[model samples]
Target: MIESWVINDDSPVPVSSAGVVEALRSRIDSGQLETWLTSSSGRLLAFVTNAERAMVVLLEGEGGPGEHAVDPGAAGSSDGFVLSNGQGDEYPDEDTVPIREAFRLVEHIVGTGSWPADARWVVDR
Candidate 1:
């Protein structure tokens, strides 16, 4: 699963990519963020919402990131429909790189840092 983190600070800290990885680790361990992976389907999803700003950042499981603005109250449905699309949305522009690539990058990044707990960790040998 590709874990998601939202940078809400108007002035984010200047840090190397390695520092970014560490920050993700901290958030994951603290339960501030969570990851969802579909083991059977090889899918990853991330959704970070800013209620105050009525913005939803949907990473769409990986290329870079996509941002959508909606009424905070309507954010749920707006975001859900986008992710549900099998192909992707035209609004984000077809030229944009596919999000699946981003998922692969996140998997690579996490594989270097830590292993996710196996979905079936206690299986009998």
Candidate 2:
């Protein structure tokens, strides 16, 4: 797993549901998370906080949503958990870099204002 920290507040002020959805869809389709896939059977798990301050974790794999209703504190201070299968490696530990990278991408594409100040990404094995 890899993760990094990104601080951006460029454009796209006050992220909306549509914006969040679009960001997620784009990231998924952009081949950005391919390196993080756990395996051929592995998947990407995205946990996000909604505009209503409700938390939802959506698995980008086959089985569909596994959990819901997770509180992520304030609305704009949104933080997310991204699970990336480590696949088979000499290392087996959780990394939070990917989370940072994902946040950076979102922040860049979304402009900035919509980006949360406390937004962080964490990757787990």
Candidate 3:
């Protein structure tokens, strides 16, 4: 597992739910996250189960119904996080960084309002 002090110091970035859902859908369809995030401007947020079998990403699209809700149709691995834009899609963990690490990175990016291609991860608190 990876932990970073930055994650603790940073708060989640608010984003548009529609945009985040669409981006995740693309990730599922193309089996890539980084490529999809290229145009996303870092407005996305993700949550993963400890088992890493399931996760949910949200767009801080304020005051919208189901902004954080996933459509029933767009789903991921039964052993992986499920996301469907009401369209068929899946995840490729081969390119998926650790979920918590991704979470921290995002928190830092959003909190600082700066995007870093790579971040330092550590195991020690």
Q: Residue 96 of model 2: what lDDT?
A: 23
**Higher-lDDT candidate among 1 and 3?**
3
Candidate 3 local lDDT, 60-119, one digit each (tens): 322222122122333334343433223323454432345545544445543453334464
With a 3 Å backbone cut-off (N, CA, C), the pairs that clash in candidate 1 are 62-102, 62-103, 63-99, 63-102
lDDT of 1 by residue, 7-120 (tens): 333123332334544543454345333322221122233322111111123333345433322222222222211222233222222112223333333444334322233311
Instruction: Decide which is better by TM-score, 1 or 2.
Output: 1
C-alpha lDDT (0 to 100) for residue 34 of candidate 2: 23
lDDT of each prediction vs. the true structure?
Answer: 0.30, 0.32, 0.35
Which candidate ranks first by lDDT, i.e. highest? 3
Which of the predicted structures, 1 or 3, would earn the higher TM-score when compared with the native? 3
1-125, model 2: which lDDT tens digit per residue? 32221211223243443364455445445532322111122333332222212222323354644322222332234233222342321211112223334444344433432224554433222
By TM-score, rank the candidates, best first: 3, 1, 2
Worst lDDT run of 10 residues, candidate 2, spans 88-97
* Cα lDDT over the full model 1: 0.30
**Could you tell me the TM-score of candidate 3?**
0.31
Clashes of 1: 4
Give the clash total for candidate 2: 13
